[model samples]
Target: MSMVNQTQVHETRLSDAVNRIAPSGIRRFFDLATSMDNVISLGVGEPDYTTPWNVREASIHSLERGLTAYTANAGLIELRRAISTYLTKRFAIDYNPDNEVVVTVGASEGIDLAIRAIVNPGDEVLIVEPCFVSYAPIVSLTGGVPVPVPTEISNDFMVEPEEIVKRITPKTKAIMLSYPNNPTGAVMSRKKMAEVADLVIEHDLTVISDEIYAELSYDDEHVSVPTFPGMWERTILISGFSKSFAMTGWRIGYLCAPEPYASAMLKIHQYAMMCASTMAQYAALEALENGQEMMDEMITSYRQRRNYFVKSLREAGLSCHTPGGAFYAFPSIKETGLTSEEFAEAFLMEERVAVVPGHVFGVGGEGHVRCSYAASMSQLEEVVERLKRFNAARIGR
Candidate 1:
């Protein structure tokens, strides 16, 4: 075949949805950092701590006992019940584990199930930005329109209800929220969240709330969306042991919703992924039961790192808002007169310091770079020194 004809055939073989979305901006830098020597990465988002020993031992015990068979499609009842109890105690919300929770491969898959269950083709999903890189692409893959409602750093990246109101339309089916958000590490105030809840109730829309970082809230106790009045029926809560328990590789996450939504998502979960790993589920159960002290220690360390990192970024001449949750510091690179991508690439190549370009995170992200403080304190200290040198060179030029 002619080269032109071969190219056309290759293009035609892929789905339109696959072609429409871009690859993850985070992964591109991650791959680059991995290939290079001595790169100090502030790019990836997982916790620096290993899964606690007790949690690992629980999984080892499960495997030793040959408890390797799949649990129910909804996951081990004990884990679900534990999740239910934890939610009640932590967020003052109640969920019936029997019919309302479905464990998935990760919070990533829980997000996929929620969007797939609720969004019909051509329906609009309001996504607050800058968010985790996956949300918009996942919505698009489902043939749903992802409407970006950009939140400003000036507001600490909190999504104002008016921004959401401006984007709503007759076809809007849902809104996606992640507080203690990714990239920016912005957490919403309860008063602000209540305002958003009011909007959701007014519009009669469903909410896909990703609360994976709920336990890592630094300044105040994290608030679950479903805890708000009138929100229980409308919110799908997604969380897991990945961040808090340092079990990213274990792939145990879950979603909770009203029976109708829960059942619909469970049906999808059954067909797409029968169940999360049995051993992982066992480990997660151990985490809920006995991992609190270790998790609390990790949170304390993260809080200290966050304070030091943000302070260093400011002193290095970058304007950074104090992130209320998560471990990222999104600092403006606007003063350097470089786009986020340019700054990130140059910083990586010259200083061996890796950060994600903010524009990849969607609207209102172009002038900043996302730096994760989830690394060791020593690495973070060195990163600040490299950043200072980089900034000085830029000024000199």
Candidate 2:
């Protein structure tokens, strides 16, 4: 102060866009669960399984071979070819690895890049909820309006074409979809996906389809929205090795879109990310080549957990729909007469169980909490018992 407050001279102002977004609503429960002993947590969306040995070994071999240098701005052409082949074989979509694919750090980054590259200042992106918490904030960061179109539990929280149709306006530029969805393990059926695809075609809107949980679908075959007739050109298909291969830390994801958008996104990616990690890229290739057996085993386990969790949650007084995919159980906590946040906080503090409040996921998510079964069976069972106790305690039992 005596020196005329020179410290104030370089005070930086953050942009309004950053200021506009709220911190994740799940942070408080997560923080409370941190380092707490005897806490049975279903709060995290991580696969408890480690990455397959073969996949990890490939990365180790790459590092041992000193393949540490950056590959290309769009990533290794060989890796891209693998991705191209994988998508076509798995989801029946075609993309030229040479020009149409860009390896991103994660599907998370691919989502951000897609929106930023195409959305103008005033354009709007319709986000289906309750979704992965990052979608809206990232859209906001790109100066696009984040419009949430809510789905219902009556329909297992699947997004309907009508809900999306009512929200479309002149400013609507794209629609972001994730299925099997996060928070809610709801998958868009092929028929339903086709309906939305038709709507997109009619409106001349782009669709950013995030299929990170593609391999985890349980009851129905996971449909790639881009596979619909006339949908490939307008779909920015995003997927990764994370969920399927238990490769979350590998941070390898990809985008496949038609020209101009692909080229445009690459420009931003080249200047920003340069390329995804070299060793991780190689690991992804290995996952594509040899990890199917491991992925199948993990999916089988997750399906068993899904069956147990849904039945136990309902019997314990929480209403949960049997999720067709992913590993989350989004049960209504409204019967306990507590808000989603209130119930989550109380559950973590009293019963020592952690879960995410659904309200954080966006509109139409209140009155529910998301419990993940991505933990061990013992942990999931114990959490259910704790939630039963929590529900009983609320009623003075």
- Per-candidate Cα lDDT values, in order, are 0.94, 0.89
**lDDT by residue (tens digit), candidate 1, 372-392:** 899998999899889889999
Clash counts per candidate, in order, are: 0, 0
lDDT of 2 by residue, 205-279 (tens): 999989999999998889988889998889898888888888888899999999777999999999999999999
**What TM-score does candidate 1 reach?**
0.98
Per-residue lDDT value at 196 in model 1: 98
Provide the global lDDT of candidate 2 against the true structure: 0.89
Candidate 1 backbone collisions, by pair: none
- Kindly report which residue pairs in candidate 2 clash with one another: none
Model 1, total clashes:
0
lDDT value for model 1: 0.94
